[model samples]
Target: MAHLGESIDVDNIVPERGDFEALPAGPYMVQITDSDVAETKAGTGLILKLTMEVMDGPFANRKLWTNLNFRNPNATAQRIAQEQIKQICDAVGFQGQLTDSEVLHFRPMRVQLVVKRDEQYGDRNEVKKYSALNGSAPPANKPQPQPAAQKPASSAAQRPASGGQTRPWGNRAA
Candidate 1:
């Protein structure tokens, strides 16, 4: 969540209001977040690059940040990223953060955030907007990536090579 600073300098402050048409309209799941970039991509069949910055929050001069996840590996992630970025920037309280890199990274601050779809949009009955009374993690978008598989351990032991078999099973300790 982004917020105003305790001693904000609105004189030097200017809210971000840029135009982008690279993405389509749909839902986006923010994964990781930072100040430099918004690594967002298509989800719910949309394509776009969503970026943002400073917005009024609990404190002042603060902004909310989030990295988008399409939750659809089959779809073009970048396209969805572009579209999502467009929607997010246009959405209320989404004071677009400017960054050269596509990845999201940023400073800490309060925010009027709407990263989660249900919390922002209520078209879907299953998903719900935020409950300000209860500050908690938003609904999850995708499943976690599974870990890699491992090989099994051997059960047999090594045998002696000097000239004879110490035992039928294996070697006998000297």
Candidate 2:
């Protein structure tokens, strides 16, 4: 162990509460920060685990996880995963075959968050939907403009200045 020059007070350090609280579910500007293919909990199939970070809004810097089971023994699960993957690809304007590296690349996109309730685990955030930033359907053949590598701005800066309203919980009207 290295010697300290001065005595430090451990009690003076304040723990950050945000790290423990669940982010209120709602639409957020997010980016894919990390991803990997891993075996399912049951050890029966593979899943693509995505770690997404909220780039803006009230819950900026918070993380939300999403798993896509593209290689499952169950046909329905595979189909649903494929569909969701297609939707994500379209939203991000990615063309051609999907690869693990490409999917892991950092890309900003809009995601709708929803609360999923479990009897044992309580409530958790889930991705409800995805959309292009321009509020229009992604072109079938054309690729959307990609932003350069840089720090993402807050949702207030990215979204329209006027209609900046956000509903954290669910779609229950404010």
Best by TM-score: 2
lDDT of 2 at 132: 67
Query: TM-scores of the models, in the given order?
Result: 0.22, 0.67
For model 2, how does the per-residue alpha-carbon lDDT over 113-140 read when each residue is reduced to its tens digit? 8887777866778887877666655544
Best by lDDT: 2
- TM-score (C-alpha) between model 1 and the true structure: 0.22
Count of residue pairs whose backbone atoms collide, per candidate: 46, 0
lDDT of each: 0.32, 0.70
lDDT of 2 at 116: 78
Model 1: per-residue lDDT, tens digit, 16-126? 642211112222232223334223233244222323333332222322234444334555654565555544333221232323333222322222333233544332211
Give candidate 2 regions above 4 Å deviation. 1-17, 137-174
Superposition TM-score, candidate 2 onto the true structure: 0.67
